[model samples]
Target: MHASAQSQQHPVLDYAISHLTDLIAFDTTSKYSNLAIIEHLRSFFADLGADVSVLPNASGEKANLVARIGPADAPGIVLSGHTDVVPADPKQWQSNPFDMQKRGSRLFGRGTCDMKGFVACAMAAAPVFAEGKLKRPLYFCFSHDEEVGCLGAPAIAKYLASLDVPPELAIIGEPSEMQLINGQKGKIAMEVTVHGDGGHSSFSPQHVNAVEYASRIIAMIGERSKRYEREGPFDQDFSVPHATTLATIINGGVATNITPDACNFIFELRSIDQDAAQTDMQALIADVEAALLPEMQALAPKARIDWEEVFSYPAMGDATGCETFKKIEPILPARGGKVSYGSEGGVFEIYGGIPSVIIGPGSIRQAHKVDEFIEIEQLSQCLTFLDSLDTWMKR
Candidate 1:
């Protein structure tokens, strides 16, 4: 028998998998609007008798959906996910990525794993949670723009932070093949642009090579990376226990005969510490600009070297003794290790004071891939996990 058969089966989860095909049909690509899906969820939750709150983004094009089931006074768990899927090109996929198709044990689509699967499973369980005579509460939080540096969740988290009945814990249902994810690496994305005087290639000495100068800045970051690796404070569970990565996107240089006047590069670092991230970035950029810009401006005197912070997601630490962690361990096989990927869990940890953990069906490997899929067997296991959750709550 399927493990879900061990307890009273939740009809809500069954409903979720069936409706997931419909949800996946809409192209909620990160760059586009998710209004159709958001509206559908709003209606579905409201019909379930949940008090739904839809928070709109600046453009009013996308929204974050928050639904509560149970008494306001009771502390509860928030089941979190994003409504956006990364863009998928038809030519890159073997099947229609927007259309959910089922083969033996697998459902294939654009977002079958990178996370609509968890959202579907959570939605399937919602009705059951709503009907139960509960001691605690359950909150469903679906956000937009998670693919874009977790931009959508901050508003929702801020709203929750303002509430008198803030959630006690948050379970960010990012795919982890059912393991509990307790840690994440921090991230800092920046774009560095170098402006130098333009001159003829014959007079190349009179103008600075912006691309060359950008390479020097990139090199500076690389030197810092080595130091971050040997003498840093990262947990060993990570594949690389260090502040890793310095990627530069090279753009500019019109003709080989002309000295390139402007070059811009975008780079990022994934780390375990914020202060270390900032300190390394500031020091490296300061030194590189101090060394390079003066020589460039000697030709134009209007040369510039500057950077902008695009976005930042904090690193997560292990959550060994937290109430949220305690709630989920009994249902999972065993405690799992840290993952390098970033999630909205970091925001919940810092802003909501609600201990958060990432756990759900599917694998990170399959997430956001061309032929993305989740095993029906995994869905069955998730249903069983939810059953365990019901039993645990009852106890």
Candidate 2:
């Protein structure tokens, strides 16, 4: 049905949609356990008779799966995708977010556009890869908690690094409307809680106001963001062309008449240079510890600030020059460049020492939004890429 805006109904497309339909049924939100979806993938890969390894995280609540088909001795390609999706609010959606709905050549579902579409395509092609006459192996790497902080990727990358011969490249399938992505910003998400001695409003000066200190810290981050915006060691390949710091959640004061005892806020920093960003954050902390903490401690001896890490992933450098890119360049739908958003592809490169690229079906504009969907044609295009990969492997 490639004519007149009709569905092509190819077997790969059909299989991918079938798998995607099942995958969307799973409520593998980042905050929830992803064991069920992990199990589904494990079973699927195991049934294919591939070399499948299910590596569970330390908490045993989530897991990552790596399945290798074809020749193992030779360096191969790794297809990576995340299983977790951001939580969906039913009230915000026109239909059930977890239930897959096919409408006018697009597949509607929560994870359909953000990821599962690519994962489904990858899995749908597993059988073909299994049976292909391959010179190099094809590896399928699926992980959990990717939506949260690339948490599942480290373990998968570690496992790949331990291989006799690591894969040649990692292609992360983050929704990019099928554009090739060579770079992305790294991220560190954290929560800061300021502790103080609460007292009546009359004694506010004597008591450390947690909300006041929290606001001060937020202001400091805002200043750093402004400085970066003004004097950026900029990367123009990204749409924003500059690093960013954002405080998304802040909670502090309980009552207007009383000084708050505690304040906590969650913030994130996205940068091209994560180490430098972290260094600056540490410097900010040192400045506060040296100056602000003592001032608060003068009034409340037990006053302190606590910093806890929520999640973190490294930024990937440009990989457009990698030999592997040349192998698949001819099939690229759009030009390659950097993206403002982050992906596990960065960790696959930085943590696992695998060169990486990002290209996949669907627009990011559809991801994490109400009525998320991926164009069915994109899945068809992805199938062509996967099949062409087999063609290259055989050559």
Model 1 Cα lDDT, one tens digit per residue, 275-347: 5778777777788878887787887788888799888877666666876566656675555677777789888
lDDT of 2 by residue, 1-395 (tens): 33124225456677788899999999999999989998999899999888899999999999998999877799898999999999899889878999999877778899999899999999888899888678888889999988888989999998998899889888888888777888889988889999999989898888899999999988888887898899997988887788888888999888899999999999988898766878866776787677689889999899999999888889987777888778767755566578888899888887788988888888888988989999888888788888777788888
What do the candidate models score in CA lDDT, each in turn? Answer: 0.80, 0.86
Taking all chains together, the TM-score of candidate 2 against the true structure is 0.93
Lowest summed-lDDT stretch of 10 residues in model 2? 1-10
Q: Considering every candidate listed, which one attains the maximal TM-score?
A: 2
Best by lDDT: 2
Residue 241 displacement in candidate 1 (angstroms): 2.2
Candidate 1, superposed: residue stretches over 4 Å from native: 1-14
